[model samples]
Target: MSGEMIYPRGSGAYFEQLRALLPRGAAWICEAGTTLGKLLSGLAVELARIDARGIDLIEEADPRTAYELLPDWERVAGLPDTCTGAPETARERQAALHQKLTSTGGQTIAYFIDLAAKAGFLIEIDEHRPAVVGMACDAELYGEAWAFAWTVRVLPFNGTQQGELPVAVAEAGDPVGIPLRGWGALDLECLIGRARPAHTTVLFAYEVEPEPALWFDFTR
Candidate 1:
């Protein structure tokens, strides 16, 4: 991968295409270089009007610290640190760590979703293979029912050979016609010019108001 930054082209067109596929409500798309944990934390803050509290099992060294600091927020256990055994090649180590993190991350997210649901938020899981995770509100909060959908893709960086690196591609697909969740697939193609593995996070958010004024309105 190259050392310089590489911004993707046709981002607007790509977003427009996704918007067309959104369920009968207004929708918005945003891309970032963060993780699911961070995204959910932000959502919790928005919904609760206070600091979003969750176990930082992904990046934090001391999960207890978060619990101590945010005593009022809901807390859960973090993922256990896994050891990557010695491997003959770099690829093996990379694969091992990737699998470990992905598995743990999914479990943590699942736990968070359940906690949110129990707290009165409606949850929606994308039915497509490897299902994307989503959440929405049943009752109108702040004048509308808010919904959020997100998906993560891990892209491993393959060292450049002969002065060229591979480009990541997310194939375009037909709109998933599910009614309750509303189907809009996120397709992201990114070029990582650096020689390091990275994760791309895609988030969609919209608000549906009550009857008469009920409609999906994209926010952020």
Candidate 2:
């Protein structure tokens, strides 16, 4: 509301304070319009400028308002890792930084899902279990390997066309056994892969809907 600065005093304020400290007889050296007075005024201006910039630097130290120090924050977070690529925009980078700072490592399905959500994705986790006699008759039979395997089903991005999702899904669908994948899959695999149980395996799946067919206008 008020167009005023409170912390760093202005150049005129600094000049007055500097003049006040001069000794009684020596005060003439800093009298208005004198050479010494002009020099002192200039020095005060520089000091005031530095003081104002110091407050800005303090603000930059905050992660939420950080711009110049964003790289330092990313380094501390160990970001731009194997999965999440370097953020392409300021907002994107800020979001990634927030995720990195707030996240505590976890192994639960909900944990992984929340991790994906932070990266702007919605996902489902399916834990596989070996077929048992009491299981439903129609349940697909899975072997012991399935016991250690889990699938991360990434739902298509909301409001996106059906065609775009498959490409992202395909890029992200690699099994955890292979080298890590990037992009698509929202860098999710890498985020969770690090926190997943060492004994278990991770897999990715994409859920896409079929596009509607074009109708012919021959009847017209």
Q: Choose the strongest candidate by lDDT.
A: 2
Q: Per-residue CA lDDT of candidate 1, range 117-140, in tens?
A: 332233332311222235354422
- Clashing residue pairs in candidate 1 are 1-193, 2-193, 26-216
Q: How accurate locally is residue 71 in candidate 1, as Cα lDDT from 0 to 100?
A: 21
| Model 2 per-residue lDDT tens digits across residues 1-220 | 3433233358878987887877778546775567877787888889899988898899678777788898888899887788888879877888888877876778887888887877667788999999988999999899989999999888766656234453522336667655343336646777778778999999887666434468668988
TM-score, prediction 2? 0.71
CA deviation > 4 Å runs, candidate 2: 1-9, 131-145, 157-164, 168-183, 210-220
User: TM-score for every candidate vs. truth?
Assistant: 0.16, 0.71
TM-score of 1: 0.16
